[model samples]
Target: MTGQDTLETGESVRYISASDLRGFVAALFEEAGLPKEDARTVADNLVCANLRGNDTHGVFRAPTYLERVRNGLYAATPRINVEETAFAARSVDGDNGMGAVVGTRAMQEAISVAGQCGTSLVSIRNSNHYGMAAYYVLQALEHDMVAIAFTNSSPAFPPWGGRKPFFGTSPLAVAVPAGKEQPYVLDMAMSVLARGNVYVAAQAGTSIPPGLALDKDGRPTTDPKALIDGGTMLPFGGVKGAALSMLMDIFGGVLSGAAFAGRVGNPHMDFDRPQNVGHLFMCFRPDLFMPMEVFKSRMDDLVATVKRQPRAEGIDEILIPGEREDRSRRRREKEGIPLSTDVCEKLDAEAAKAGLAQLNTTPAPFAGK
Candidate 1:
């Protein structure tokens, strides 16, 4: 089933089943030269973003991914290697593989080491764009472990007070499990919002909200196109966010022996060069200091306690981070994912270029009320 949302501005959004979208994306990836397993892995990560309502990181990225593959910037089949293995830490070289594939392997190692040592950290370098950070951390929830993930990307933002672009969005995500409650997941970019969101807006011909971006001269602007034209993104909370972004750049990039600060290449801008992005994933058993059940109970209690707090003016209820996304995922699973017409058109065009059949352009409305 599917649903349609008509904007006041007369834009009509069509909802496509997640399974359908995933299959189509996988087919496209295969046609672009990825192994069938790798194709499915990439498809699953992108569809997960769509299910969580983060369309900026979803199937819309297929074209650029294929372009990189064709340009020899992204390796369709990579030989990822593990180096400097320790009791509780390790480093990985991605061999320029797709981030989803590299990240899944790295996170699996973290989970394995954490199972034996109570904690583990894995650093990865030379990977291409990894989909939503939450996808990796959420893997730890199944093992009753807490997870934290971070990644650095090509420079698209400046230092706190400086005007020159110096760091990528540098995203971070954390996840913890709770008994009888949805796991808490917090995923966010250090920037005000992901740079991909600006690209999405540009494709949809929508205006970005004021203050989210600056023109090439560092002057605030609402034009999404400006971001594509060498503009900079504003950090989420100015100095604080900028500082956190810098930290991610240092640990996730520089310390990992990947590209850092301005040295990183952007798949969009520095297409001729490799991105050499870096990621960090850490996981630990929540029961390291307490019983697993005890930790889960306390987490549930904390969520309930926060929900019972006095409501603020005009606010319905306080929500835990990732709650909205969980809700969105459930709703989308039943009603299908809403995609802008512009996005479908782009996908259709990409499929044609890849010698694959076009995806269904019309969304199927949900059968239920």
Candidate 2:
């Protein structure tokens, strides 16, 4: 699916205010069965995706999640249970709850434990897609702790050599405190690009860059639809990325005793089955390894030094990971999140099907600027 395939000629796009969208999604989740607080958490996470320019995992996924809930695949009232041990490690059973809610709870638990133990690990099983991994890691930053987060998803890409899909676009995120600069964050999937990026490119009728994905038969292809239909995504930078992805799978999937990529069901296509996704979270109090003040000052110096490097001819400055995203988020929060015509239509259809009032398409408060 390319841009031309989805966008009609001369069709204009409109923006949706984040607060309105967040409220609507929260209402939808509550109507579908989640508790009010849990619904709010899930909605916030989903909206954050759009705010950060990751529309593929944003509200676009709500319809599928609702369908799964209605189909009895995901429990409306989940019973998340935890098992703790002596090693400052814990395991949580999501009991088929919304991944975002469960993941947030897991991180909360990890942070709490880390405060007591100086470091802690939490693994979650039987969860679903949890939106961006960075959101959960950032939660620990408020506690002045360094954090790591990982999650496994449905099989969308193949192992390095094999043609068959055997791994999810497993992702890892890390956050570290800094003194003067913004907190340092790194979040990325092992794949060359996120599946959401491929879908967005396909919707825009654009060819993906080379080396991103392969067609169904394992041949490299720039067409986005090829990636959607039984194609494989290449790992970033070859073997190293693949190795990291495998490691994430082990920590998030295998260690959590949850289904790995091949065994986990796809949420997009398999509406009647639980995704059984897994996640790993860890928090390390800076005071545990070094003085919090010293660590933060060092991080601030590191960021400043990197920003001082020579830039390309047209570029003014180099951006560390999460810097640009943080800027975009602040701007969008005040300006509103832009939704392409295609996404707007999809949201409207979902509203109609769910027997809810349609979102107003008129220019919202943050539309123009």
Best by TM-score: 1
Q: Which candidate leads in lDDT?
A: 1
lDDT of 2 by residue, 201-289 (tens): 77777778897888998899999898888888888888788778788888889999889858887877777578899999989888876
Candidate 2 — worst ten consecutive residues by lDDT sum? Answer: 1-10
- Give each prediction's root-mean-square deviation over alpha carbons: 2.0, 3.1
Clashing residue pairs in candidate 1 are 2-365, 2-366
How far does residue 94 in candidate 1 sit from its true spot (Å)? 0.2
Number of backbone collisions per candidate: 2, 5
